[model samples]
Target: MKLLLAGIVLILIIMWKPMPSGAGDMWRAYSDMREANWKNSDKYFHARGNSDAASRGAGGRWAAEVISNAREWVQERTGHGAEDSAADQKANEHGRNGGDPNDYRLLGLPEKY
Candidate 1:
């Protein structure tokens, strides 16, 4: 009976959940969010050349949503308001000027008076 009780206690201790290490988990979460945000931002800027405002808006909105989500996730996970700094840098670096003429700027075709 004592042996059985000892085994049970050991099992219980093994199965118990360990407490979260705040900073370590938070850093991991921040890294994950940064990756996701970079992907979504790339997709949006890649498709931004479309003349359709609706499509552009949709892409923009999706990018914004993902970026915002990543920002909030990082902030909550890290307990700091980093606000998607990595993603912003990625957008500014690779996504902004890598595309065609129409993609670099927001100006559409000239209006027909």
Candidate 2:
């Protein structure tokens, strides 16, 4: 009975993913940010990544939350300013909650983004 319950729980977790591409989405956003190298655009990328992943469903939202929190926690200790980290977290939350990432995007950004 215990084994069966565990198996059922595992199955539920597996079934939660509409697709297993959330992490990749997050990574792509990071890569794009690096490529863009646009000043003051980091918050936009953070929101975009979380929003992109969250739109995929619960699994994606979970991945985005985990990755965003972990990244910010690391950054807080790695010489990044407190204000910047706080703003980043705010952007991340905004996206995860279905807020439009474009709200954070800067004008004049190229269409390829």
Model 2 lDDT tens row, 4-65:
99998986687467335777788999999999988898888899999988988878888898
TM-score against truth, every candidate: 0.23, 0.86
Model 1 scores worst on lDDT over the 10 consecutive residues at 46-55
User: For each candidate, C-alpha RMSD in Å?
Assistant: 17.3, 2.4
Q: After superposition, how far is residue 95 of candidate 1 from its true place, in Å?
A: 21
Model 2 bad stretches (over 4 Å): 1-19
What pairs collide in candidate 2?
none
Winner by TM-score: 2
Residues 1-113, candidate 1, lDDT per residue (tens digit)?
99999998875554332212222233333454354454333323322322121123333333433444465567568755354555444443333233332343333322210
**Candidate 1: TM-score?**
0.23
- TM-score of candidate 2 against the unseen true structure: 0.86
Residue runs of model 1 more than 4 Å from their true location after superposition: 1-55, 81-113
Error of 2 at 49 (Å): 0.6
